[model samples]
Target: MSKTLTITDNRTGKQYEIPIEHGAIRAMDLRQIKTNADDFGLKTYDPALMNTANCVSRITDIDGDRGVLLYRGYPIEQLAENSDFLETAYLLLSGELPTTAQLNKWKTNVTLHSMLHENVKKFMEGFRYDAHPMGIFLSTVGALSTFYPDAKDIFDEQSRLTQTVRLIAKVPSIAAYAFRHSQGLPYIPPDNELSFTGNFLNMLFRMAELKYEPNPVLERALDVLFILHADHEQNCSTTAMRTIG
Candidate 1:
């Protein structure tokens, strides 16, 4: 049988019944408790939001008490141990692990897009040398919207996919340039031959050397860290980004 909650009002000696779903009652169900048509019925009183289910995530899940985290039905620990950042990203986006061909294609596309447009570099250079790196990073990302106005087509799947790849590919470049600008150094172009995190390190730290090879241990460490931190279910920053998105 289905479930419901019964409420008894002492003032009028009246009772009310509210249907329940998923072992919970909707706030709207409480509206039936009013004694009169003019009454506002029951209203929320959660000033501290101590009793709230803020959001329902389709991508990730967290069970704090159990110390468990999963991404697309796979435990996070397994992914961190067995997969890299790009593979985890593919699973998060497509809801499954990729085949060898799929992973190769994804890496190739991301690598090819690692270089930021020359004009974007000029835009970063416009900021004062002393500007905060974080501030420049934020403004640079905002400016990216203008450069890819098609990203505004939120309802279109192809547009979203295109822009997601572009943003993910170019953001490391943007961040590297931001830091380099704060120190008044010429920006280093992305090295596509390197891994995703490796290219970012190259851009951020490469000096006069014509070739930069990222350390194997360091590269894998960064990749694993990226996988671990990738999806924090509906945190403050993700919430704000979701609102903006």
Candidate 2:
């Protein structure tokens, strides 16, 4: 027999069988279980989403009971040890790890777009030196939507690709700017020669050095962090971002 949830309305003595999909009953399906035809039936009140699956996603899977997480079907530990952030990001976005040529193209495209517009730099400069870096990052991220009006073309594949690449390439630069601005330091532009994390570190810390070199260990650490946190399905922060933003 096909999977289904047979819900009994004890008050009316009515029973309804709702189709179960992917081992979960849809909340919308419950709307059919009314006290009477005029009644609104049921709504799930899951505070903190303890018993809720907020979305359907193919990217990440979490087995909280077992303390395991997977991104694009790869174990988090495996990805952390074997893949760079950009490679992991490509995997999540494309549903597969990139080939050597594919990764090279991805890296090159991301690097080329690392430089921020002069106006964007000036916007970051307008913030108070003591302003919270998180606040600045959030505000600047919102401001980015205004910078790329074409990103509104949600139906266009190329537009989505463009916006994704732009956001991925530019967010670290803005984050670094936020860090420097909080310290009352001049913002350093992105160094295309550096790796993504390396460029970010350079932007945050390069003072008089002609070439800023990020600690190899820290760079790898950041890459690992990026992989793990890249897509935390149904995390509170993710929920808040979707609700507010």
Candidate 3:
């Protein structure tokens, strides 16, 4: 049997029943609360939304009490043990693991788009020598909107996919560029021969005389870290991004 929540107003003894929907996780239906004073005759205050359930999501779930986390219904431990970052990313975005051909296509597209626009490099030059890398990352991402105007029309499925790939592919380059700028090092172009994390490592640490090599153990460790931190339930940045979108 499904559960329902009953809310009663003390002022007029009015009652409202909200149905509960169960998925891989559980969430209470609250779409009925359309307005603050009009619907409930009062406002709820939750500074920073510290204890609020503002929306429902099907992506990931965290059980802090049990120290358990699941991504797309797959346990984090299993994914860390057996899956790579791209596989984990595909699962998070598409709700399923991709077939071999699909994964190859996805990886090819991501690798092909790893290089940023020439104008993006010029934009990096404008940042002050001591500018914080995080600030630069934020501004560079915002600038991506201008570079790809199609991103504005997300209603188009193809445009949305293109922008999504561009973001996933280009962010490592952008972040690496920011770090290089801070250190007064010339930017290192992404290596097509390398995997995603390998390319990022090359861009960040490779030098004119010495090439960077990714260690298998370290690379896998970083992959697990990325997969684990991919998304959590409405942290500060994720909540802000959702609110803005």
Candidate 4:
């Protein structure tokens, strides 16, 4: 049987009926609340959004009360134990795990785009020597829009794929550059031979004398960390980023 909520207006002795949607998860539909607010003179409030569900999603699901977390219907424990960040990313974006060939192709595309624009590198020199890495990273990411005009066409499949590759490829370089600037160290360029995390480590920690080497344990741990942070439905920062997009 379907369920409905009845809200009575004291002034006019009228009532508003709201339908309840029941599924694997139960939700109350509230889209019309604002439209009828004047008629009922009703006030809606949920402090800290304790009981509110603001949006719908097909990504991660978190139930704090139940201590459960799922990403694309797979348990967090299973993903953290069995999947690498790139595989998890493939699942999140495409709603399925990628085949070995697909994963390889995606990784190759990312590797090919790993270098930052030379002009962007020159622009970083203008920042104050004491500037924070995070500040520099934020500014440099914003500056990316100017370098990649093709990224503006979000509706184009190839453009979207290219920008996705660029973002994954470039962010590590940008981060490493920011760190190098903060430390007054010469920037270490990406090594195409290294895996994603390995390359980032090379850029972040390599010195004139010492070369960075990838540690299997450390790389796997970092991959799990990235997978864990891949998504959280309605997370404040994620929501903000979506809204901005």
Superposed by TM-score, candidate 2 places the C-alpha of residue 137 at a distance from the truth, in angstroms, of: 1.5
TM-score of each: 0.90, 0.92, 0.85, 0.85
lDDT of 2 by residue, 1-245 (tens): 87988888888898999998887988889888778778887887887667766568898899889999998789999988988999999999999999999999999999998888888888888888789999999999889888889989999999999999999999999998999899888889899989888888899899999889899999888878887788876677777776465
The worst-scoring run of ten residues by lDDT in candidate 1 lies at 47-56
Q: Write the per-residue lDDT of candidate 1 for residues 1-245, one digit (tens) a residue.
A: 64978889886778878787655677777776787889988776775456655556679988889999999999989999999999999999999999999999998988887787788888888888799999999998999888888989999999999888998898889999999999888899888788899998899889888899888898889889999888887778766665465
State the weakest 10-residue window (summed lDDT) of model 2.
236-245
The clash number for model 3 is 0
Tens digits of per-residue lDDT, candidate 4, 1-245, equal 55766767565566767766433222333333443445443345666656655567778889889989898899989999988777887888888888999999878888899998899999897899999999999999989999999989999998997888788789999999999999999888899988888888889988875557877898888878888888866778766665465
For candidate 4, report its TM-score: 0.85
Which regions of candidate 3 fall more than 4 Å away from where they truly are? 6-10, 13-18, 22-45, 241-245
Total clashing pairs for each candidate: 0, 0, 0, 0
lDDT of each: 0.86, 0.88, 0.82, 0.81
- lDDT tens digits by residue: candidate 3, 1-245: 65776767665576777666542212223434444556643445667756656578788889999999998889999988888788888888899989999999999999999998999999988999999999999999999999888899979989988988898999999999999999999999988888888888889888865667887777777788887887775678777887576
Which candidate comes out best when scored by TM-score? 2
| lDDT for position 173 in model 3 | 97
Tell me, what's the RMSD of every candidate? 2.3, 2.1, 3.8, 3.4
Indicate which candidate wins on lDDT. Answer: 2
Residue pairs in candidate 4 whose N, alpha carbon or C atoms collide under 3 angstroms: none
Per-residue lDDT of 95 in model 2: 98
